[model samples]
Target: MSNSHYDTSFKGLCYVNRVRMVKPSKSDPYRAVTLSVKSGKRVSTEGKGDKPEFTIPLDCKVVGAQAQAIFDQILEEHWDDKKPPVISAAFEVGDIYPDYYVGTRDKNAGKTVPILKGRLLKLHDVYVKGERIDTPVETADASDADTPAAAQPETASAETREDRTVDAVAEEAASFPSVVRLSKDDPDFEERKARLKAEGYRWDRENKAWRRPAA
Candidate 1:
């Protein structure tokens, strides 16, 4: 696909299940490595439940210093824990493209697979056996849940609290940004409320907020 056809940035926590160096082929002069990754919010699941997995092929020849550091860390974890590392990476697809293949031994011989041609922009974190250890990104927001109320602004009005909550919740719902809390007094609230409940939003009667997991 063209560069404009794909998203500018791709972010996810990919659990590496396996890694191996690929021998150079006639079409490609340099060797490469394939990272078999499980798609999930976190690798702690150990690839359990309903998460899907895929293989991302990265050229090892030009992985650069940053990518090499992450690869080295992953190799260390693999050797010590005998388990693959969970790597969080942000990817761009400007130079990356899909490659079609056809082989007798291949399951989907005629299908195409996306070959990551761009260098790894950043290695956000690494996990061993589902436990996070190394992280390069700021995690302050993650600790907000445990922050003391006294540390926050107490002078903010109720309307301000409601507005902030709505904005925060809206940003979290990247896929379903239309999701919102409706009051019981609204004419169609009862009808739509039931559907939201079934979809996993929990009604917080005390706070008057309907919350679901962030996107």
Candidate 2:
């Protein structure tokens, strides 16, 4: 357990090996996912460490229903034991708090470790000894309606409020650098752009697409 902050970019080939769960006195256990890179360098403000392997502990047991559903979707899509799913991850290390039920060893000790909160930004084929696993992983893309909105009862209302809040903030900040793009050729391009417009997104004529916040 170290007090050092892990504020660094951790981009590498890694695996969502497993989830570490912690139980409370009388509640469902909370789970934290363990992401590991067999060989990679840890980049921090102090400097970069040529660490052979970097294990990142992320807090995935989110509180909000919408968020938890998203996290669950991520897990269901990428984490499977029968056929290990590999991924190319791009993330930055954040904070790791002292917890009584977390850590590789001594689950109840309340150890403080540098936690790297991140997401599986990209999914890749599982490779062992530089060979791809034959068992095809399910790459079916799930729609937004299939997840967050439907996963929780409060998701639609919560999202509507959130969208309004973001819209208000974006308008007040006017110049805020929070924009993204969508191609006009996309199947739902028009509908998507219209929805984004209502959510504070705008058309970037220069980019030939719609734009919105990174969030």
Candidate 3:
């Protein structure tokens, strides 16, 4: 299998016990949250009338400012409840890789068990019980009235801006060619190159271009 990174999105159940903050060391004070998302499908068993559900567990880490903030809010809301909340969320993950570790439980003791691991890039929506959470909105504070309107930064609301940005990006991506070439002479060459790489395009040395097959 190739080691190239790719993006994936899914809906899953997140148990409180499987979520926590991690600080590697005092020297490297960067913080991250680990989330275990359970997702799967049902499969019919031979000679059985019912379909048995199979669970696929993805152990992922959430980093970045926006994603981490969302994670923190979820923890703060339900971390200490008498009945731990099982959160349902839509997750966008990236750079997924196949990994394995020695199993310590019965039957699979001392044997390697495969696992899927990735970076939690974004959380589209979250729910506890049946109520939706994770709404991304920034409202103007009452104190803002005291400040001069001209001095206040001009920016679109978070939720509206993000939604439009996602839609724009999706529309642009759909118009992309199977392969893209860039010239250093372009003013935005560097920025476009970075964006292309993040979108799974690889530099083709021979062709002097970035290339990726169309989905």
Candidate 4:
């Protein structure tokens, strides 16, 4: 692993970071290497020895080996496979180099996503052929329960609780016996109601509904 540091005078060991990459062009077949050499952040327009530099995005799962090798080969004037390297390497739109697409190598479908540098690639709201993967449920468990998200039970909607209509709402107004009016003096009426709720509010299983103390 030769350090590609840009200090022509002093050079021995250098480390490179994988930033974003772009697609390579015909003139510059080899992907452009965006490096932070001593000259600051600049794109290597011309690959080693007069060959045009490539420009590719870096969001794909490009292994450290592939990236480093690409850089080395381009810098030396020795491109093995001539006709526009089919790009066997992984690349993505935002990857640091022209490598592989992130989701392009998902061989096992939704079972697993590739772990790149200890980071998992997530595809949320995923589905296949109009079939959704995440199902709708209710009363599985408290959302905040200490359980791995993968193993956590799916939550059920409130309507599934009492077989109530999904669009229905149970307002406490119907249960009130007296006219509970609000006054300008108590501008923070909602706060008082919440405080009272925190104190204690329970449902009576026998009554089949909620029960509140007289105000």
Q: What stretches of model 2 exceed 4 Å from their correct place? A: 1-14, 20-22, 37-70, 92-94, 98-215
Candidate 4 lowest-lDDT run of ten: 5-14
Query: Over the stretch 6-80, how does candidate 3's per-residue lDDT look in tens digits?
Result: 344444544323564344655432334345555455566788533325446676765333454455455544454
Q: Tell how far residue 103 is off in model 3, in angstroms.
A: 2.3
TM-score of each: 0.37, 0.29, 0.46, 0.15
Clashing pairs in 2: 179-212, 180-211, 180-212
- The superposed Cα distance between candidate 3 and the true structure at residue 130, in angstroms, equals 2.6
> What does candidate 2's lDDT look like per residue over 13-88, in tens digits?
4544454444588875444456565455544444533334465455433222232233333443344446545443
Give the TM-score (vs. native) of candidate 2: 0.29
- Model 3 C-alpha lDDT versus the unseen true structure: 0.56
lDDT of model 1, residue 177: 38
Candidate 1 vs candidate 3: the TM-score winner is 3
Model 1 residue runs over 4 Å out of place are 1-9, 22-31, 35-64, 80-94, 104-106, 109-117, 135-215
Task: Give the C-alpha miss distance for residue 83 in model 1, angstroms.
Answer: 6.6
| The candidate that achieves the highest lDDT relative to the unseen native structure | 3
**Candidate 4 lDDT tens digits, 1-215:** 11221111212111223422233564321123322122233445455322223432222332233232333323222223333221222221122222322354457444433232211111123222233333222222211223334565658777675664534534443444332333337889657544433333222222322234323
Candidate 2's clash total is 3
80-164 per-residue lDDT for model 1 (tens digits): 3444345444332223445544444567566554444433333455655555667423322211324444465578777776555
Where model 3 places Cα greater than 4 Å from the true spot, the runs are 1-17, 25-52, 138-215
Assess each prediction's global lDDT (C-alpha) against the native: 0.43, 0.43, 0.56, 0.29
**Ranking under lDDT, best-scoring first?**
3, 1, 2, 4
